[model samples]
Target: MLPRGRRRARGPRPHLLPADARHPTGRGRADGRAGLPRRRHAAAAGRGSAPRGGRAGARAAGPRSREGRRRRAVSDFARVASAADVPAGAARVVNVGGRSIALCHVEGDAIYAIDNVCTHDDGPLGDGTLHADRVECPLHGALFD
Candidate 1:
C-alpha cells in the first residue's frame, strides 16, 4: 500500500464507452468512446444546439456571425444617475438586470461600470476601495478593471 498522500498507479484508461449508457444520440460517454450515433436538436433550441456547420465551422464564420460583436453592439444604455451623484474617485452600486453593478467615477471625470461581485469569490466589489481605474475587492483584495 502507498502512503496516505500517495496515489496508486493505474493502467491505461479504456477507450470504449459502455454500450448501455444514455446520452444524446451519437455522443460518447465519459470514456470518450462513441456509444451511439449523435442526434441533432431542433434549431429553436437556442445556444445549446450546434451552430450551423458545427463548432469548427463557427470558428470560420468570423465576427459577423451571431453572438459576435455585432450582437453585443445592440445594447442601449440607460442613465442610472446624474454625473454628480458619484463624486470623483468614488463608486456606487447600482442594481440593473437583477445584478449589482459598481459604477465608478475616477479623477478624469471618466465613468466605468463593472459587476459588483468579485471574480475571486463573489465578494461585493462595491464595498472595496476604488483606486485610479481599478476596484479592489474588500474580501480578497482582488483587483478588477
Candidate 2:
C-alpha cells in the first residue's frame, strides 16, 4: 500500500506547462514536423482571435459596449394615465416615461403593468382586445389572457 500522503504509481504526471512555455520560440517540434502547436496556430489563423469568431472575441473583450452604455443612459419610462382613469375589468394603454405600458385592472382593484408589446410579435397590446384579466395581441390573434 502507498503512504497516506502519496498517490498510487500512475504513469507520468500530466504536463501543466502553458502553451507559450511548451513552444518558447512559438515554433513546432524539433524534427521539423508539424505538431499539435502548429495545428493550434492554423486554427487561430482560421478563427482570427483566441476567442474564435467575432462574437466570441467581443465577449472576451468584457461587458458594456458603447451602444449598451448609451441605451442604459436613455430613460425608457413614460407617465401613463392615472390609476383612477383605468376602469375595472379592463385595461388601458398608457405611455409612461418613454415606454408603452399595458395597464391592467385585475381583481381586488389592483393595477398590473406589462410591456405593451406582445410576446408573439411587436404588435401593440393597447390596440388589442382585452378580456377579463389578459389582453390578446391584435396582429396575429395571440391571446395573453
Candidate 3:
C-alpha cells in the first residue's frame, strides 16, 4: 500500500539507552522537556579538556646527544703575503687565519691559496677574475675552478 512517493524501510534502531544516556541534569525528554540540541552541553562547555601530552605533546624533539659532532679545521699553514706582497701574475686578498685567502701568483714560483669567499654568494674573491688557477665569480659569473 505504498507507491506515491515511496516510504517503508525502517532497518536499523536498537540502541535503548546505554551509550552515556544524557538529558538528566535539569531533566528534559519524555515530554517534561527543555530545548534539546544542547550539543553535548555545548561541546563540553566549548571544548575544555584534552591537553595532557596526547600526540607526544605535539612533537618536536630530536638531536639529543653527540652535541652535534664538532669539526672545524681549516688552517694548513697561512701567512699570506710576504714574498714581496704579490706582483708577478697578480692576485692578493689575504686575510689568512681568519680566512678569505686568495693570494695568487699562479706562475713564477707559484702561490695559489684559494677561498677568498664566493663559493657562489659570499662574492668577493678579491673581486674575481684571476684566470690561471681560476676565480671569476664577481657576483654571479661563477667560475671558481
Candidate 4:
C-alpha cells in the first residue's frame, strides 16, 4: 500500500571536467596570472579598436596602479553643491566629470573633496561616520584622512 502521492526519480550526475580542461594554463589563478584571453575583448574580436595612451600607459592605468598614469587637470569645474549643503563635520556625495566624489566640510571654511569609495573594500565612503578630520567606513571601519 503506497501513499497517494507522485514521486520523481533521481537524475544522473553531470560530467566533471578534467583539471587541465578547467584551467587551460598549468598556472592556475593562484599563480598571479596577469594576461587574459584576447578573444574575450571586442578589440581582439576586431569589433572595437585597441585602448589609447599606448601599451605602457594602458597597463599602468589598471585599478591597482591608477596613479602611475599621469592625467592633466580639468580646467572646467562643475559646481556640484553649495558649501552650506555640507556642514562642518558632515559629508555629501556628488557626481562630477562622471565620477562619484565625497565632499567633506572640515572646521572653518575649509572643504575637502575626495573619492567616495573606500580604498580597503571599495565601499561607499559617503555613508561613513565623519570624525574631526577623517571619515570612517561603515562596513569595515576603515578610516580615511
For model 3, the stretches where C-alpha displacement exceeds 4 angstroms are 1-79, 84-87, 90-95, 104-115, 123-128, 131-139, 142-145
Ranking of models by lDDT = 1, 4, 2, 3
Residue 75 accuracy (lDDT) in model 1: 52
Each candidate structure's count of clashing pairs: 5, 8, 0, 0
Q: Best TM-score goes to which candidate?
A: 1
RMSD to the hidden true structure, all candidates: 9.4, 14.5, 23.3, 13.8
* lDDT at residue 41 of model 1 (Cα atoms): 61
Which ranges of candidate 4 are over 4 A from the true structure? 1-76
Candidate 4 Cα RMSD after full superposition onto the native fold (Å):
13.8
Output the worst ten-in-a-row residue range by lDDT, candidate 2: 29-38
Give lDDT tens digits, candidate 4, residues 1-145: 3335654435744435444344456544523333433257766565555455456345445444355645654565678889889988888999988889999887666778889999989989888888877888988999898
CA RMSD (A), model 2: 14.5
Maximum-lDDT candidate: 1
Whole-model lDDT, candidate 3?
A: 0.63
Better of 1 and 2 by TM-score: 1
Position 75, candidate 2: lDDT: 54
**Which scores greater on lDDT, model 2 or model 3?**
2
lDDT, candidate 1, residue 87?
81
lDDT of 2 by residue, 1-145 (tens): 7647787767855566545445557455433443334455644567555554346455555557667642333454445677789887677887766778888886778877888998878998877776666777889988775
**Candidate 3 lDDT over residue span 28-65, tens digit each:** 44334343334565335545443454633222443234
